[model samples]
Target: MFSNTPISANHFLIKQLPQATAFIDKNFKVVFVSDKWVEEFNLSTRDIINEHIQDLVGISSKQWENNILRCFKGKRTENFQENYTSIDRETRWLKWNILPWYNENESVIGAIVQAEDITAQISKEQKLEQVQFILKETNEIGKIGHWKYNQSQDIFSSCPMINNLLEIEEDSKLTLDEYIEFYKIGYNRNTLSMAIFSAMENKQSWNEKLEVLTAKGNQRWVNVSGKPLYCNGKYIGIIGIVQDITDYVIKEHQTKSNEHLLKTLINNIPLHIYIKDTQSKKLLANRSELDHCGISNEADIIGKDDFDIYDKELAQKYRDEDLEVMISQTPMINKELSQENSDGTTNYFLSSKIPLKGPNGETTGLVGITMDISDIKQKEKDLRNLIKVSSEQNKKLLNFAHIISHNLRSHSANFSMLLEFLIEEKEEAERQKIFGMLTDSSNNLMETLHTLNDIVTINSESTTNKKEVYLNKQVHKTLKHLNPLLEENNATVITAIPLGTSLQVIPSYLDNMLIQIISNSIKYKKPNVRPEIKLSLSYVQNYTVLSIEDNGIGLDMKKYGEKLFGMYKTFHEHNDAKGLGLYIVKNQIEAMNGKINAQSQVNVGTTINLYFNEEN
Candidate 1:
């Protein structure tokens, strides 16, 4: 100790520190180890200090050991990774740094080394790489990209695909404001801003579609979604994704435009139109419907249920029908409906309701249209009435034919029997009496046949003979023709004819009609009482009114009201009362576009009013 002790120089002096360290001696034995090495190997320093390096670290592979031995033989090696087994029989990764050591005379002594357990770090790196690879594959397949925003830093970042979707350069850096500016100028910006704000402020998530202007000045559609990250009630910036959807957007717009055009065309049609939901009894109507209901605008009726807008009973009936259509899942065409509106007016509609179906052919709703049919309905009613009248007339004609045949055959048979009896008898007196009776009967039969032929002709001919004639002059002519009868009945004819009163009529028919009517009045004059007949004509809009009032044996209209104009229907049993007069008069007047009606009582008098079309 007195003299400088000879230093037993060893490369293990630097390598055998307390921290993780390793050493190789001149003979390449692991002669030194640190505390971490001792713990790692599950051995004492005394046990591993003098062991060969391969045995200490359990490097059983010859190839790996050769590399380590070569490194120890003066070849400097740094950060070499290899698998090694600890004393506990657990294998793990270890990294070693190796350097050759030398003595003062520059002779190679051994090598110094440092080792670190890096199994956890290497495993984490491998897992991260795998996750990144999977995310790349998913992004490519889905055509989606993730994006992030940092509010505090005012920075926006997106994955590469997002930039591609927006047609932006890969290396472009965008702020949130700049990114929002890329949205189209109209509703797209508003919708996107609302979605983003809701997500960031309320810690919510939203998905929406928006149009964006791309770098190439082309517009594109994209589906965007975002979710806010909140920590302790404080909102962090949003993370989201965007997907290109330009094709879908264009298709949707085209479909909507077509639908709108269809609706517009339907609204412009001049008919009542409406639609209804299948299950709910509600009406969706158009502008024409508003006009039909006498309302100024759609707001007057829109959203009001059928019960509120229509009569309760009618609404219920309509709802029941719609329910049936929906249940049957069929189309109903030209179904007639009589509906009452809110204003207490009724309308006729020809309706068609079709079931709206889902992809599976299940009924989801109903679409209905109603066309205004009020005018058509009116025309149909008129046609039915005409048919009824024609049927009645046919029956009357049949009855008339039977009467004529029976009367004629009865008279002929009587005449033939009388002649046969005359042939059988020889008395000249009896023969002459039979002859007189036969003559009277033959005369009566001939008169009846003539009347029947005249009626048949009048009925068969068309009643459209139209011409302009002065009604006042016709009345004066009729009165003049009846002057002799009036004189014999002590009748007084007073006329009150307005100047220029005329009507559309057949000239000859009108004269005959007036003659017949005036003759009847004078013929049925009260006996021992002077008959006073008043004839007055006045002009009304579209018509000339002729009123003939008589003071005579008034008719009992209650008994012979409907038969007044019927052939062979005589109200008076007078010798000259043919009953054909009024019948012919009515037929002639009606044929000339005129109408005649009578009001009478048993004792008072009769007033006959005739309306004729005013000459155009």
Candidate 2:
């Protein structure tokens, strides 16, 4: 890829600049990348040209993507310093600018990016922000000036500009002793001497921004640079420039303070902000996140992770996402996580996590922010359920209409036939048989009406006042209530509902569903087989599961299972099998936000599984 191309010679003045730079087409395909860009990223021209920039380099945040998009639109963005992890996995604070490159026709062709690593400078500034701010505000007095200090004479003097900047006498013959006193003690005195000495000894240039006490006893912040001056190749003096840069210093101070202000703001905000050190896996969480974990605001989170305070499953999930962010060195934005609420509901949050980098372009840690989107997610969930409920109700309504019309018509026809037989029959026995048939038809119609009424009642009331319905207690109550019927059938009931299996459901509805299911097992037992039923309860994910198994004369599931929960559908030859028990059980389950299913095989056994929403 680097084969004999004019650009391969590194024959551009832009290559001579210290900054790392590269140019890429609208497709993010590299066209011309400077040597410094290749060197800084530790890449070769063969690896860069025609390769997607992001594939060969590392950057985080959509802001970088937005900048590139803007450049594609022929706009220019400049001077935003951010810490980035390079392709070589080193972290550096880069100050960068991206501009649209123009073609011969003056149309935008591609984007040119330039960046300088300013990690060392920013790191030093941060460590000394407070002290530097104090010194600058208290002691800044000079403007741009020039001065000379003779090493042999141990003398210091300056022009009018320097004297004015220091607010001193222009003709004052300042000796090295007098000049030394002008530098405030500590860093100012020590640092200034070191810079000057280093410059003189090495015959090189040196610069420092420091504070000084003037001849008039007023303090000042100054930018001073010294160059070794030689006479016939022997060092004689140092020539220097002195400029008051107090305005720029104050601005820099404010800019640094904004970071602290940002931290304070984040702590107070409702959104949860979390940061974790990758090496230690220790979290630094804001007040909202701390509060979520039931921790006091004053408690330190520096050595803790999600696993330290959250549920194991939830913590594991979060830990995985944290690793994903750190590994990709990318932002995972607007991801959803749902947590159970104390009130037996669910609350969802949208979170974003991105890798945080250190000064040397290393992925040191990651930061994330999560905002509660419970209201929105709840609305979405409700909408989905409503749509499902609406469709189900529509189908049920059509089925109801068809069944009611056909069954009522059949009963009416039976009434007419029985009345006609009673009126026309000459024999008393035939009239008696017609009367019995009429009574049976009337009872059947009433049973269907009762089942329809139950369904209608359940469908009308959409709200449920749910509480913690303990499974073991409810199951025992159901079994105890039907003990007499079980005794008649010589049924043996076995239960293995371990402690603490509970659900969020309406008290009556929970009892009704269990009773209907458990009673069915006993009611439909195999003859001479000594009926045995097993009831087991457990918790999985966020649901409480209750399963009932019965060894009985099971029906052809393929023919009957589809309509097992439908109104007035029965497969067994039992006097009480109006087919409404399973229907009522299904409705009760759904009323409490639960689900039901059955599995059966002829002459073997049947198992019914019910899942209820567990209380959180």
| Best candidate, lDDT | 2
Residue-level lDDT tens digits of model 2 in 1-616: 4445334465476566667888788898888777888887778655777888878776655878889889999888865888988766788888878888776677887788887788999988887997867655444344567778888887787766667656788787666556656778999889878878887788789888888787677777888888998889988989888887767787888988997898889889999887789853556788898887778863567788878777889888888988888888888998887889778988788989989998987888888889998877778989999999889878878987897788889889989888988888999888888888989999988976777787778756454577876777888888889889888888898888888776677778778877787777777878889888998876678777788899988768899889988877888777887777888788777766677888999989899888886542
Q: In candidate 2, which residue pairs clash?
A: 90-361, 91-360, 91-361, 91-362, 92-361, 139-219, 139-220, 140-221
Cα RMSD (angstroms) for every candidate in the order listed = 13.3, 30.1
User: Scored by Cα lDDT, where does model 1 land?
Assistant: 0.76
lDDT of 1 by residue, 1-616 (tens): 2122122354345435655776566665865566777766666645776688767766666645554566656675546787777766797888766667655756556666677788898888889999998888877776779889876666789888988877889888888777888899879888878888887777789998888998888888888899885568777688888887787879999999999998898789886676666554435677787776567776667655567656788678778877888899878888987776668977788888788788998877677777888888889999999998788778777877887888788998998899899889899999899989999998999888888888777666564556677767777777787778878777888878777866777777778776776677777777777888888876667667788888778898989999998767788889888778887777666555566789988766788877776542
| Model 1 CA deviation exceeding 4 Å by range | 1-250, 269-453, 456-464, 488-490, 538-544, 592-594, 601-605, 613-616
Error of 1 at 612 (Å): 2.8
Against the reference, the lDDT scores of all candidates come to 0.76, 0.80
TM-score of 1: 0.49
Measured with C-alpha atoms, the lDDT of residue 60 in candidate 2 is 58
